[model samples]
Target: MKVMFSAFVAALVIAFAAPMVLNQFGWSVAEQTSSASVRLD
Candidate 1:
């Protein structure tokens, strides 16, 4: 049980921190996907 709990905590931390780390490198999801949208100007 203790090992499982630790693993869950580690996964949660990674899930939350990974985005911030990527954003630091300017690799945000919104910026990447926005380019694919049609600009109906």
Candidate 2:
């Protein structure tokens, strides 16, 4: 039971921390691409 609890806590911490870690290196799911152009007629 203790192992399961620890695993759950670790998973939660990783879930919350992964995004910030990725963004620290300029990697993010919301990153924008400049190659796509929009044409409005």
Candidate 3:
């Protein structure tokens, strides 16, 4: 019920907020988006 819904919201916040917070310290999380067209030759 309420607890489960709150936990889900908290998890969502952490997933997005954690990376932003960490990046402020000169760190970054790996991105795996499909729109990237990088190819190392």
Ranking by lDDT: 1, 2, 3
| Candidate 3 global CA lDDT score | 0.78
Stretches of candidate 1 off by over 4 Å are 30-41
Per-residue CA lDDT of model 2 for 1-41, tens digit only, reads 99999999999999999988998987765565533567879
Compute each candidate's TM-score over C-alphas. Answer: 0.64, 0.69, 0.61
Number of the top-ranking candidate, with lDDT as the measure: 1
lDDT of 3 by residue, 1-41 (tens): 99999999999999999878987774654443343677889
| Better candidate number, 1 or 3, judged by lDDT | 1
Weakest 10 consecutive residues, lDDT, candidate 3? 26-35
Encode model 1's per-residue lDDT on 1-41: one tens digit a residue: 99999999999999999988999998986887787658697
Residue 29 lDDT in candidate 2: 53
Whole-structure CA lDDT of model 1: 0.90
Worst ten-residue run, lDDT, model 2? Answer: 28-37
Sorted on TM-score, highest at the top, how do the candidates line up? 2, 1, 3
Model 2 CA lDDT for position 40: 71
- How far is 26's C-alpha from truth in model 1 (Å)? 1.5
lDDT of 2: 0.84
Candidate 2: clashing residue pairs, number: 0
